[model samples]
Every structure is written in structure tokens, then in C-alpha cells.
Target: MKKPLMITSLALLAGTFLTSALPDRFIRDQFKKAEAQTELMLAQVAEATKTQPVGKPALVSPRTLTDAGELHMVPARDWTSGFFPGQLWYLYEFTGRKEWADLARQFTARLESEKMNAGTHDMGFKLYCSYGNGYRLTNDPAYKDILIQAARTLSKRYKPKAGIIRSWDHNTAKWLCPVIIDNMMNLELLFAATRFTGDSTFYKIAVSHAQTTLKNHFRPDNSSYHVVDYDTLTGRVIKKNTHQGFNDESAWSRGQAWGLYGYTLCYRETKNPQFLKQAEAIARFMLNHKNMPADLVPYYDYDAPGIPNETRDVSAASVMASALYELSTYVPKSNYRAKADAVMASLAKTYTSPVGQNRGFLLLHSTGAKTFERDVPLIYADYYYLEALLRARK
Candidate 1:
């Protein structure tokens, strides 16, 4: 009888611990709240479009990206243009509502021309976020063609000798060939293109880029710098710095998120052990950072001189939550799920909008760039916030 009572007590204590660590009810409710906020955004966009000319056959460039506390509209060709449609597609996925589906189709259709825009490395963000979801959910034949074309266009930017996709086309005084850590993300589209078309060209290019980035982008401590400049003529690394971070050596929060998310995702598609190990290292560095907040959200930059006084990046948190969810699946001994759940719960409870406000954005307190542009809502923040919720739901 005594032994049985002790076992029962231990079981009860374990249950309590897990309850404290996980917030299932809160995340479930957050999912519903996200769906509701998206519904309101649809109606608001419709009204805004009546005067804004974001009508039929127009690109997916409705108003988003907060500047001066107002969400400004970007051209459809803008790097961020895909997220608005991508959000609508996510809403449709969550609700199974025909209205959301109609809206998603309308917005996604406008970005078709991006398939041929060969100058930018962000074609993945613009195409995969919009058409990738469409292809995944609906199997729309047209989405397939668009994605393949976009992949081909993106491939044009790859510098074979440098073994990386040049991130920006406009020449800069800083470097001739700039390869950002963010460009690692675009490899997913190339992989997808290879799978869709049975063309080994896309697959080889992606693997090469990953290898080059893995060799050059990270530090001994595993925290990554934002940009690696290469000599285009000689394929040699010129400099490493954080263009968007506080300084060259300071670990930028979103840049770290991109490394974690990109490598985790790379491992998933390729099952490459190197990618897996790299993702885990980044995860450990981020989770074990002394300056990380109790809530698991981080300051805009880990080495920012302000420390606790610096603005917290909700965007980075959302990205981390979503990335950690996937990373948790790959490793056997990883405690990443607990941390992931806690971060999502924090975002849902503290950072999220209870007023259903912030121009229909979900999470707040996101810093765009540390150039005194602190505490602003961003379209990518909302997009990844919904994405993290969906991954958590599953």
C-alpha cells in the first residue's frame, strides 16, 4: 500500500510539472484567436482595396510592413509581398472556409510575374510562402509551374565559384558578392524544384550552397554573423559583418533564427547529418544564452550593449518557435519541444493582440531593424506567428 501511494504521488507531481511547462489550452485558444484576427483583416483589406486599387489581377501588394506606426503598402514585387497571401492561405488551412480560400487565390494569383524576376534572392519568400502553400494544400497545377519557374529564376543568381547565391544584386562599396545567412533559406525552393521536375541541376546547386554557407557563415561559438562578403572575381571570402545586427560579432536574433530554421529545414529535406548538427548547435547557443529572457524571447541582438533594455524581437521568437518545433522532431534527446511550447505560449499570452488590433497583426513588440526602428509590427512576424501556431497545433 505504501509503495503504491508513493508511485501515485510521483505520477501526480510529474503531471503538475508538465502542466506548468506546457500550455495546450492557451495555444489552442490562440489558434482560434489567430483565425478571428485574419477574418477581420480580410474585410479590412477589402475596404482598403476599394480606394487603394488592389483589385482583380493586381499583385499581392496590399498594405503591410509598419513604418511610423502605420502599415504601409509595398509593391507586389517587394520581397515581403508574398506573406499577405500566405497568411490568407494559412487561414484557409485552419478554418476550411471557402471565403478564405477565395481570398488566398485572389492574392496569390497576382504574384505570377515573380517567376521571371531573376535579380532577387528572395524569390523563395515571395513564391514558396504564397504558391508553395497553395501547391501543398490544393495541388493547383498552375502553382507547380510558377514555383518551378521561380526556382529557375532564382538559380540564375547562384555564383558557382563562390558556391552561394548572391543575396543582393545592386553593387555595394562594401563587397562585390554578398551572401547573407538569410540566403540559406532560399535553397528549399531549389530542392523542391528538383523534386518536382526530376532535374538534378536544382538539387546540386542547393547542396553546394548549403555546403558553402555551412563552411563560411558560423563562428566558433555557433552564433552566426549576418552577412559574408566574397570576392566575386576570386571566390574568396572578404569580410563578415552583421548588416542588420548591432555589430559584426554580435549575434543578431533574427539572423540566428534564419540559421536555425534554414538548417533544420535543410536537414528535413536532405537528411544531411551536417545540417542537423549545425541546427542543433544554433539551438543550444540561443537557448543557453545568458541574456535570453525568462519567456524565451530574445532581444533584437544577443550582444547588443543595452542587454535587458533592448527591444525584444517577437518576430525572432515566432521564427524560433516554428523552427524548434521542426528541430524537435529530428533529434532523439532534444528538450526543444518544452522550450518551443513555452515561447509560443509567451507570444500568445503576452505579445499577442487581445484587442484584435495592431492593424490585424498578431504578435507585437517586434523590431524590424535595430536602426532605431524598435517595437514595430511586421508582416513577417504575423506570417511566422500563424505558422508557429499551425505547427504547434499539429
Candidate 2:
């Protein structure tokens, strides 16, 4: 449902022992399990490629859970196109295998052009997740250029009047300029751009967007609305609505996860106390909710009308886990670390695929959208799950 962030908070390790909730053995075992599971899926994707009626590699499918339960991948241009490649990079980071590196390179190659595509706000998701991680691990000069290009493209979408990056180009009739909570997650690319080139333009854009998002995207409870429509001509707020959540008024599980993770990252990048406060408020709303599942994996929407029966979104849980782990670093007074650990624990215990199931994915029961794919295993879920694991011990 969303994308990258973090290592861990030193504040967390310095404050208290997280071992009670996330033990060393559990972390090692999950990686071991992930390695075996990932290898299986890699082979499965390769084999599936062999049978394609078209004469291309297997990475061309949507990489989404289909009606037939196949691990079909989409084109390199798809919104989710970067995830599977990004996953391969994570595999390389975790396992230290050259084969993973080779495959990661090949998959990352597929998205090379997206760095210049400004059609959407997710260049951060597309290029940053794959090449950003690649540049971090490899420091390839070529990869560095790609990351800069993508950051520049993403910056093009920023509306100076609104002080926010535009989320979508096609929703003009409904929103003069729609700014979604997910855009906050993309600011990392801008921050990276500034760091690489010493260009304050990128940094300024990132801070401005975050500040505007803080002003308009949240509510009294700090549970975020998915989209905030702004009058582009005057930069005025017009309406707030949810496109992926159950209803405009409900707190979508994944949307909240985006806000928590996004603001936590904002605080990390800027050391701004306001961002930390925003992140903490979001954390409290979700944690103190009456309907939050005991395991910490929330329902598709907190107020989706059907409680106890609504599908659990492991994707949201994975995201919240990763975010909480980072948020814990900034706030020593809260039990965010324990909550993050428990979410990962539940995923490993309940949501993980059996040895030969889930099309070789790790976590399961992640809802992609309401009334569709209620219990599918999504690639982003697997990405964040691994991320949370890596964060657990860092």
C-alpha cells in the first residue's frame, strides 16, 4: 500500500531492551524463513516466465495476486512495478547472495525510465524504492543519477500555491489538486536529492509539502483522510475524501500507516518536534482505538461498520510495525516499540505463508482494496514485513 523508510531509533535501543517482544532468535528465524521462501518464489516466477504465451521474462506480469492465485507481474510502468524489484534488493541486503544482486540489478533496470516520468507522484515509490535502495547498497554512480532524476521529476508535481506535491493528474474534476497522505512518503526522494546535490530547492520543497500536509491532511484525532482536495488556483482546501478506504469519514488502516510512517520520517529528516507530535498523535489514535485487533493487525478500516468480521490488513500491520519501530526511537515514553514487535510477531505467527503456500510470499491476508481481494498476499506487504524485521534489531 506504501513504501520505504528507516533503520532504527538509537533512542529505542538506548532507552530499554526490546528483546522481550522481539527476541534475537525470532529475528534470525524469520530471515531464514524469508530466504527459503524468497528463493522459492524466484524460481516460481522464472518458471512462470517460461510458459508465458508472449516471449518475455516473468517480471512483466503485474506482481499482484490474481483470481487464479498466480504471482502475475505487471509491466515496468505499473504503479506497483517497483516493488518486486525492490523486494529483490531487500533479499540481497538480507541474504548477501550474489544471485540476489544480479536479479536485483535486472529488475531495477526495468524502471530506469520512470525516473523522468512526472505523470504521477509515485516516482519516489517507483525509482526510490528500487534504485534508491540500490544506490544505498551499491553506491553506483549510474544509480545515483537515476535517483536524482526521479527526485526532480517528483518535484515537478509540487504545487507551490498549495505547498504540496500533487498526487494524481487525472482527478482534476473532483479535486483541483489532490494531495494524498501517501505523498508524504515520497518526500524522502526529495530529501535524498538535496543531500546528493546540496540543492536547497529540493529540501525546501520537501519541508513545504510536509508542512502543508500537516496543515490539511489530518483530523482532530490525527487519523488521516486519504485525499485532501485543494483549490489549485488559490491553494484553498475544498474537501476531504477517501478513495481506497471504506468511506470518506472512516480511518483506513493503511492510510493511517502512511501518515504514521511519513511523519516519523519527516521528523527524522528535519528533527522537527511538530512532526514527532503529529506522528505520536496518529500512533495514539490507532493504538487506543476500541476496535483494533488484539494482534495489532487492524481491520481494512477502523470504522468499516463490520467489526470482528472485516478482513485483517496485514499490509497495514506491517507498515505500522515499521513506522512504530522508528516512532519509538523518537518517543521514549510510549510503548511503540512493543507494539511494533507484537505486530511483527503476529505476522510471523499467523499471517506468514506456510512453507509452500501464498505464491512464495511471506505475510498473508493483506487487503488491496475494499470489496476486492479481501485476503490476498500483496508484494508491498512482503516488502514492509521484511523492512520491519530488519528494523526490529537495528
Candidate 3:
């Protein structure tokens, strides 16, 4: 009996060693697959470009695929419009290919006009992912200008009384002034704006928003609510809601990822220990949750009713993997890198789209929301997958 138990222990140890040792090879293989898929995407984009009206700027950047197996492209105003170009930038960063840089530049140019679009709180998701990466890679002064302008535009959504940025202007009937946990991501743009211009106003606004969110958005267990509506006139909490989760109280998987990534960035920018602690707490909550699948990809909602039968969200996994990679750098004593590697490996092995299929998207099985975009490929999933791969390589 003792010999058999020892053999089982050895087998488990060997399995751990094998899984731990595979990330380098996995990153290479995944990038190779991504390159092939992106090549097909370039051709599709060219074909789509040809059909644009003579005077119109082509708004045909790929977002996802339709239920009929056709590609779904969106305009620059779309929140996800920046991700494909960001993926191209990551490809260039990884492979050092001049062609990828040229293509990235071309696609990134399409979103320059979003600098003045203040309709949404996704300036970071749109402009920062596109122009921010572009500026980081090339030190392009024009990209810097666009990022600064976009940050200024995003600041327009800030409600001083609420001490938070309003997330949705269109949901006026449902929310007086809603601040979503996802808004934590856009604070990165403001932080960058301060760095670019030496203006502390952007920094202060970002800090205020983060502090306010820290006070209001989190559960005692560190799982976050998706949305917190406030009284903009007096900075009072009106209600808390999980607009996209299973219930008003359930944790939305992607929203959790957003908070994890967002708070990590806040700590990076502000060097605030509270933000770092929040990030670690969120990581622990996610990793230690009983419902977390062995592959590390989470269901669309952590508390959704259909546990084993629920849809998996690869996008959330990708975002969390990317955040974990960055967080690992900040807290080298933690197990974040290993966990990130596990998630990335799972995604590489199980979540990637088949070669030259899924309309050239690199990942599959992401749920954009409870009802919409269920079990489909998402552009941001590929974006963060490429990002996590790059971070892993570093």
C-alpha cells in the first residue's frame, strides 16, 4: 500500500513538473498559430476594404463572427475596435516583423478620430490599447497627442460629486450615475495622460475614482459588483447591480477579470499598497473559488445556476492571465506567474480557434454577456492572449 501511494505521489509531482515546464513551448506554438490566423484576417480585411463606399472611411474591422459563420466587423466607435490593431502591435512586438508594424500602423490610424468621442467610458479599451501601444512601440508623437486628447475626453465623464466616472450615459432610465467595475480600466488612460503632460489633474482624478471604487464596489470577499449606481448630486450610493451577471448579486466573470486587471494597473501607476492588496485579494478569490474549473477558465458567471453546464468565457481567462503576469512582476513572492502560466496553457490547448477557421480569430468559447455573444470568439480574447504570451516571454 505504501509503495502504491509513493508511486501516485511521484506521478502527481511529474505532472506538475511537465505542466510548469511547457509555457515557453506553448507560447511559441500559440504565436505561430496566431500568425497564420491573422494572415487570413488581413486578406479578409482587404476584401472588405474594397467594398467601402467611395467617400467613407472603412469601418470594417473584425469584431467577431455571426451565427451564420460570417465575420462581424464594427466601426471605430465600437469599444472593441482597438483590440485587433493592438493584437497586431503585439505580434510586431513579439516577432519584430516590419510588415506587422506597417499593418498595425494602418489599422491603428483608423481610430485616431476617437480621441474626441466622449460618449463612452471605454477610452482606455479603445484609444489606449491602440494608440498607447503604438506610442510605446514607436514613440510616435502623434500617438501621444491622440492618447492625451482621448484621456481629456474621457475625463468629461467624471462626476465630481460622485467621485467616480459615469460609465453609461445611455442607461439613464436604469441608472442615475452608474459606475461599473470595468471603469477601473479606463483610469490607465488618465494616468498616462498625467505622465505625458506632467499634469497632476489627470492623476488626481484617477486616484479619486480608484479610492471611491475601493470604498463602494467590492464585496467583503473581494468579488466585485458589476455596477454601482450613485447619486451624482451628493455622492451617495443609490444601488448596486450586476447588470450582466446572473443576478444583481452574482459575480460576473469578465467583470471580475476587469477589476483584477484594473486594480493591478492602479497599483502600478500609483504605487498604492491598497490597490495591490485589492488585486491580490481578487486573485485569491478567483483562484480559490470552488467553482473554478481545472483548466482555470471560468464560467460566464461565477455564481450562475448551471454550474457544469454553463458556458465558459475565454475572454475573462485571457484578461486575468494578462493581469496575473503583470501582477507577478510586482509581487514576486506570490504564485501568480505559475497560475498565469496554467491559464495560458489551458487557453492555448483548449480555447484557441482552429487554424484558418472561426473567421481568423485566435480564440473561441468566450461569452460577451449572459445572453449576447454566447460561446463565440471575441477579438479582445485574442488581444489579451497575445499580450499574455508577450508578458510570458519577457
Top-TM-score structure, candidate number: 3
Candidate 3, residues 1-394, lDDT tens digits: the string is 0001111211232124223533466567778878999999888778766667667556747888788867778889888999999999999998899999999999999998889998999999998998899999999998999999999999999999988989988778888999999899889999999999999989999999999998999999999999999998999999999988899999999999999999999999999999999999999989899899988899999999999899999999999999999999999878888888778767765676667677688888889988789888899999999998888888
lDDT tens per residue, model 1, 1-394: 0001111211222123223444456555666777777766666666555554445444345444345444465666788889888988998898798988888898898888889998799988899999999899899998999999999999998888888888986658777888988887788899999999999899888888888999999999999989899876778999998988899999999999999999998898889999999999999999999998888889999999988899889889988988998898888467777678778766755676654566566667888678955776667888888888788677
Q: In candidate 3, how many Å is residue 179 off? A: 1.1
Sorted by lDDT (best first), the order is: 3, 2, 1
Per-model CA lDDT versus the true structure: 0.80, 0.82, 0.87
Q: What's each prediction's clash count? A: 0, 6, 0
- How much lDDT does candidate 2 score? 0.82
* Model 2 lDDT per residue over 247-293, tens place: 99889999999999999999999999999989999999998899998
Which ranking of candidates, highest TM-score first? 3, 2, 1
Clashing pairs in 3: none
Task: Name the candidate, 1 or 3, with the larger TM-score value.
Answer: 3
Quote the lDDT for 364 in model 3: 85
Least well predicted 10-residue stretch by lDDT in candidate 3:
1-10
Measured with C-alpha atoms, the lDDT of residue 204 in candidate 3 is 93
Alpha-carbon shift of residue 276 in model 2 (angstroms): 0.6
